[model samples]
Target: MERAAEAAREGNAQYFLNLGDDELIKLCQKRDEDGRSLLHSAVVGGNMHLVQLLVERCGNERINSQDSEGWTPLTSAVSCGFEEIVKYLLSLGADPNSTNAQNRTPLHYAASKGRVPIIKLLIEAGAKTNTKDIAGWLPLHRAASAGRAEALRELLLHTSKPLINARDISGSTPLLLAASGGHQAAAVLLAAKGADVEAEDKDGQTPLGAAAPHGQLRDALVALATGEKTLDDFEN
Candidate 1:
């Protein structure tokens, strides 16, 4: 098992290159103490050849198999920001909505890392943009809080207006998260996308209130909130 993991992780195909079919099956069946299979390590290693070899030679059941952390190959690829691997997995029927231990999907990870192209691929592959994690944070919330403006825009392209104003379990909207995180660009983008700036969190703080510590951000949100200015004003 260790040897298999090592080969998969280091992109060393020699370990499995000449192995017999039965040997390959036994190796693929074994998991590390962490419950990660060779496929998991192969995805983490970013070796497309190994991935193809395993999935094609073995079977598809392991494609969505979760380790102890509940991560599938699709989830791992998205986490590592490997577009080609993600695309390959999706093309081979990997679930776009696969979730990990935190109930966070591939879209959630892509949004947080600001993987714009990956974000588009995941959404196009049928990833749900509004699915919440364990914290009730949606992909939109993740992008906004992480200040991923382009990723957020990609998500917005598939979101409904009601979802645009959706709040998390903490009652924080994407705009509120952006403002609290001092992401002026994200805050502006959210507002322009129809986010309710007047929306409040559990603390009774609106987006403008959340941006109070950042003078420029606060003023920008305030102007947009009151219709005194538009994002176009700044962009123009």
Candidate 2:
């Protein structure tokens, strides 16, 4: 099993080829100490050829298999911004909405990293835009919190009607999260998209109120809350 994992990490295609058909099958079925299959190792290593070989042998059932962390190979690929690997995994029938232990899908990973191409692929592959993680954070929440302005824009454009002001477990809307994270661009985008800049979190802190102390764009946030300057003004 260790050899198989090592082969995957090194992208050693001939190692599997040298083994008999049944032996290769057994190797493909093996999991590492961390409960990750050869497919997981391949994806993690960004070894596209190894990934292709493993998927060809093990099929889509293995593609959707989760590791100890509940992360599918698709999720792993997405998190690392491996665009080609993500596309290949999806082509092999990997579920775009497959979740990790935190219930964060590939879209959440892509959104967090601002991987717009990967996000588009996942959405096109039927990932629900409003899907929530264990923390009740939607992909928009992740994008906003990470200050992924382009990813946020892509998400809003893809969804039929995004919950612009949807609250998470902490009662923090996307706007509040952006403001709390000091992500001025994201905050401005959310506000322009009709997020309630005045909406409070569980602590009753408005976006402006929450951002005042630590936010780099405190003045911009203040103007946004007061409607003194609109998103269009910033865009222009």
Candidate 3:
């Protein structure tokens, strides 16, 4: 099974072709010690061709198959920023909202990596914008916490009703997370999109208040919150 997985990772299509169709089916169904299928290995390898080949032989049922960490091929692809592989997997009936053991979806991974295209793609593929992970964080929260302004923008735009001020397990909104992380541009974007600057976390730390001691752009965040500055002002 490890050899087959390695072959898939190496994009050695001939390896599978050499095996009879029945043998290939068994190989595809086999799992490694970690419970990862050939599809998972193919995705981790960033080989879209191998992924397609495996899916074609194993059927789409394996597209959403989860490994030990509960990461599916789609999540793995999104995490690695393989936009083409992600799209192909989704088209092959991969569930965009499929959760791992931590309840983290592909959207969460994409947002964290700042993969704007993958974020947009997953959202369009029916990924729930408000889906929370084990940490009670939505994809928006992940984007903000990662300081991914472009990814946050794409998420907000695609979401029908974005929970701009939604709280995570830490009681922190996207704005609060962005501010605490010193993501000035992300904070500005959240503010422009109706995020509440005065919203507090479990520690009663408002966005600007949370940013004051740690972030270099605390003043700019305050100005943006108070309408003293616009997002365009930061572009200059």
Model 1 stretches with alpha carbons more than 4 Å out = none
Q: Give the total clashing residue pairs for model 1.
A: 0
> Arrange candidates by TM-score, highest first: which order?
1, 3, 2
Please provide, for model 1 over 140-203, each residue's C-alpha lDDT reduced to its tens digit, 9 standing for 90 to 100: 9999999998888888888887888788888999999999999988999888767887888888
Top lDDT model: 1
Error of 3 at 122 (Å): 1.1
Model 3 clash pairs are none
Candidate 2 lDDT over 185-229, as tens digits, reads 888888877788788888888887877876556777667768788
Residue 6, candidate 3: C-alpha displacement in angstroms:
1.8
Better of 1 and 2 by lDDT: 1
Indicate which candidate wins on TM-score.
1
Encode model 3's per-residue lDDT on 1-236: one tens digit a residue: 87888887887878877888788888888889888998888888887777787778778778878899899888888998999998898888899999999999999999988998888788888988888898989989999999999999899987655489888988999999998888878988888778888888888989978888765577777777678888888877
- Clash totals in order: 0, 0, 0
TM-score of 3: 0.94
User: Who is ahead in TM-score, 2 or 3?
Assistant: 3
Cα deviation at 165, candidate 3, in Å, is 0.7
